[model samples]
Target: MSVRWSFSWEDEEWLATRTPPADNNLKLAIETLIVPFGRSWQAVDNYLEVWRNMELEHGAEYSVSTPSAAVERISRDTVEIGDLYDQFEDVRLPVDEFVTLLTDLSAAMRNQ
Candidate 1:
């Protein structure tokens, strides 16, 4: 199955809220990670509602893979868990290459 890997910090907060203790964790995730991306909390709320339904119906697995190894490989400036979409843009990897990378990422996550 294909996955959508967003580096938007807004998206991260949305993911955090899907779990229990929605407010605290959502705040933490936003302040610590999402805020730097210049996202609005209100927009995050709207997107979360939409994404939640999609994930539930389609079984899409949204994930954050900030493994130490991956971080080291990508380097700190661009490899941070909250900056993947930026990295994806910077790297400008072709669609085929990106699919290969995602495939590899999935395999690694599964192995772990």
Candidate 2:
């Protein structure tokens, strides 16, 4: 699946005022993005564990075409999502874009 991020007008205004935001503003942005990102990671890990258990219990009936592929996709997405937080120092997305990224990341995790 592919996710696209978009910015809202309010986000535009907020970002416009603070390309390189004050330390406090940056901290607030990080906090806002990280909490949900962490939650999504937890949820994805739980889901993968449950899926593995179901497959173990049910054999072929519960088998997927490629279980490793699913895991890899989730891992890749998670890493990419996590990178948003990790690389925040190098990038300054608008608030709306940041929010959109978080929302999209969460959706990707849940969909998995």
Please give the lDDT score at residue 15 for candidate 2: 19
Q: Cα miss at 47, model 1 (Å)?
A: 2.4
Task: Write the residue-wise lDDT of candidate 1 on 1-112 in tens digits.
Answer: 4423323224343222221232443223333433332334343344345434644554533423222111111321222223333332122122333333334333333443
Q: Pick the candidate with the highest TM-score.
A: 2
Error of model 1, residue 15, in angstroms: 18
TM-score of candidate 2 relative to the true fold:
0.27
Number of backbone collisions per candidate, in order?
Answer: 0, 0
lDDT of each: 0.32, 0.36
What is the Cα root-mean-square deviation between model 2 and the actual structure? 14.5
Give residue 30's error in model 2 in angstroms. 11
